[model samples]
Target: MRSSTLRRHLGLKHEFQYRQWCKANDFTSMIPKDVKIRKNAAEAAAASQTIIDDHAVPLPRKERVIPYSDELFQQAAIEWLIETDQPISALEHPRFREMIGIAACATNGVKIPNCKATRQSIIALFKKNLYDLWTQFAVSNFCCYMVLSAY
Candidate 1:
């Protein structure tokens, strides 16, 4: 049967719902549980203190998370705007310019190695540092800010 017809018959609006319906029909509706959580619980109950496994191979060490500072990020943002020729005033909307500024600064080479900024991270950083960005960049004596205020 066509997907639309099946959807209409089954009243499924999404693919996950269809998969759930298939699981129900196939008698495998129960979702799989994590093996590690169960093992951890069993070990906790069995021993007074847990011991580390020396025989187990150690996982690779992750890179240290560097804390963000406003000064460094703002400098990067200004430099990025200058280098990329994406001056804040040229953008149509104030909010979009601010968001781009945040992305440019927050994903600086020192902070995010290779600077592959995700939209979610940019948005989060922008929201977290909204006041700083506004006071430092938006309401400042910079030419761009003066032009933005005029609009």
Candidate 2:
């Protein structure tokens, strides 16, 4: 097979491995030096293998594992709870925990905050948002005052 055809096949059949190889080395230099085809052996192998319909075979699902941060997750959860008007106690509910566990797919399951922890997170978030809003308001008012004084 031509070098281009072989590269295309590798890219399609072993995409992840091909990408990793490309990242580690120049792809052009990585191509095999020898390209040979035994017609008899190829024909025998092809005859022995049964052809299957593509529609009959289900494609494998790829799962990407992303690093999890407890602090970020807790902050996001607290914000979502507040936005949805749910009680802090909801974080400790078995059903809610189960749902999070299923969604997170962590080996040990995600650690959800208890009522007290949830309340604390909520308070922290509120204080941060309030400070941000106050700063914006103060800056805008100062700018307005400066413009008025200049006039």
Candidate 3:
């Protein structure tokens, strides 16, 4: 079960027992002495860092300029779907679309390619990869043949 669900169950079903257990167990005392020492050290370091940061001059915020290209985005989305073994229909999912939109930094969200376009893009990418592999194999074989001929 999810942590939230488990917490809710414990709170609703065993509130009394949980309170008794909390009262009985000194949680901090249960921790090893070394761990408690390290925890205190970390807290002290964080406090010093906070003080230093407060005294430091603030830097000017620069505006980030992200170039948006629909074709590139679609290609990337297609590749991501293929790499993750997700169905083409995943593009149409509301949550997925929202995430994509947020990532692309678009207020209304970017338009995702339809299933047909996505399928075509996947096929094209596969053919391109196959061609690239074939070319590499051919080049390697040619190099080997040339070396053999020279010898």
Candidate 4:
């Protein structure tokens, strides 16, 4: 197959990496100069079976290794959670609002600029009506449950 056709078929990226890899290896000279590209009776019979044997070698199949990255996905869920609520809902109280704030801070390690400023921001952000954002964040733990289940 034409290289361009195969590249397009595979959605092959023309990135620096593949170019570097191609430059590092000489496919044409992989066999001795005397050897023909196509298999010939003389070449096949006299040649070490190494080349053909290498072709028969199968790559190790990648085992499914689902990772549990609670920290990584916690932020990812924010987008989905935002979809479920309006910014108005983002301000209103949901379930377990206080617990929600502490958990959100703990899970994401939410920190204030400094402890004094953090206290001030928490006081401001967790006012009665707006505290619901924390509950929404705690419910985010359910997404963590999802990553756990895959393993």
| Per-model TM values vs. the true structure | 0.23, 0.33, 0.33, 0.18
| Candidate 4 stretches greater than 4 Å from native | 1-46, 51-63, 79-151
Please write out the lDDT profile of model 4 over residues 29-115, one tens digit for every residue.
222221343457567677754557656778896555334477755564566468766453543456535645565555334433778
Clash pairs (backbone) in predicted model 1: none
Q: Candidate 4: deviation at residue 33, Å?
A: 12
lDDT of 3 by residue, 70-147 (tens): 898788889999999999999999999888667666654456689999999999999999999999999999999999
lDDT of 2: 0.77
How do all the candidates rank in terms of TM-score, highest first? 3, 2, 1, 4
What tens digits encode model 1's per-residue C-alpha lDDT throughout 64-94? 6556688975787678779989867645567
Angstrom error of the Cα, residue 145, model 4: value is 50
Q: After superposition, how far is residue 64 of candidate 3 from its true place, in Å?
A: 24
43 in model 3: Cα distance from truth in Å? 84
lDDT of 2 by residue, 46-112 (tens): 9998877765777696555546799988988999999999999999999999998797776744565
lDDT of each: 0.63, 0.77, 0.76, 0.56
Candidate whose lDDT is highest: 2
Model 3: how far residue 118 lies from native, Å: 0.4
Q: How accurate is candidate 4 locally (lDDT)?
A: 0.56
